[model samples]
Target: MDGDDRAGGLTRRRRWPWVVLVLAVVVAVVVAVLFLANDREPEAAPQPADPEVVTLPVPTPTIDPIDVEPGTRFFESLPRTVLEYALTESTADQAAVASGAVEAYRLVLGDGGTTEVVVLASQWRDADAAGAAFDELLAAEAAAAGIPVDQVGTPTGSADDAAAGEQTQDPAAPTEEPTEPAAPTEPTLEQGPVEVDGTQVGRYLLVTRPDGSGTVHWTNGTALLRLDGPATAVRDVYAAFPL
Candidate 1:
């Protein structure tokens, strides 16, 4: 029995060396696989970059700096006159345009009391110039402005003296009595209040005859342009005019 035990022990010892050799081979194979995996390149998926955005500047609106009011522009279109009168802020009211109108027109004047037109104005050199201009525009070549006659006054005198002078004249006589013609009626002006730099500088309304029609009229500047309708019509004359 002892000899058999010793033979079994020898066989076990020989198998132990082969097991150690097999373990060493398995460890070497594992290390080689790990090194190869580390050295190999990794796969990557490409992603697109975010797009860029562009911005533009917005445009701004434009505005007119001038007074540009219809009435203001009406006066402004005329020849240069007193700055105050030219620059004066005026209301554009509806006016009546007589059928008799032309390129050079005379506006039928308006009365402040009864008519819708303005019978008074400023900046003309004189009444003669104003009337002359009106007449020229009406029946002549110059631009016509409206002129209005306001009130017809009664002359102060004795009717008896006129009757006695008439009675003395002989009806049978061929010669007629010479008499001096009465003076032409002049417009009596009523002034408006003028303000200069916040102080009073009394301004006044100018009076003129309206034309063939006995009426009154008013305006601001010289070299008149007679538009024959209402204030809106005056504004309608130009589309660019600012009302």
Candidate 2:
């Protein structure tokens, strides 16, 4: 089922900022923005890339027990940066994205004792759909947090993740500090933890109207995930999910 069509009762198409392919330039832009945001200090070179691939199942999105961890039942823990970078690396191959179908995961992690993380891992129906949604999600997130964002032309192809590389980490990777985005803008932001159903969410963002809820939400094939929490816990959430 399409992620947008899952809501049976009241479903309506909401116009979101059009997302182009997740290309090299786009990734660079995102990286530049993160740097400008002072999200991190000059750190030692990125751990020697242990280019590896970790595949997860494609499942529908839904709330699970709070005690139980989020994401698919397959992989135990995957980090945000690794997944993001892998997706970036996979796009370098044009022929790959053109005639390829990968079973991957879409994850949204943040720091928090009770924040909700949405890990939408699945096989995308096509490259176009994957790239479009991936870019759109990035734009929406930037706008919500008032992070300056500009759309760029799609170069070659831009879809994240692939079966190309094995997912492995340099055991020497830094685990001490969590790289945090600059304080996000809050047209509607709440502090402290809140309860949803029977679970307590540390924090969450209600982006400008038409901006609905959920910290991060996207779909690939039959899989969808919406992980959200407070702004304060964003860093923690990202750190919690180590690929």
Q: Residues 34-153, candidate 2: write the lDDT tens digits.
A: 888897666787678787888875322233222334444433343333222211111122332343324454444322223344444434465455555555555666565555444221
Under the 3 Å rule for N, CA and C atoms, how many clashes does model 2 have? 28
Which ten residues in a row are the worst by lDDT in model 1? 80-89
TM-score result, candidate 1: 0.21
**lDDT by residue (tens digit), candidate 1, 140-217:** 211122123222222335799899988998899798688997553543222233344676433223223223222222
Give the candidate number with the greatest lDDT. 2
TM-score, one value per model: 0.21, 0.25
Against the reference, the lDDT scores of all candidates come to 0.37, 0.40
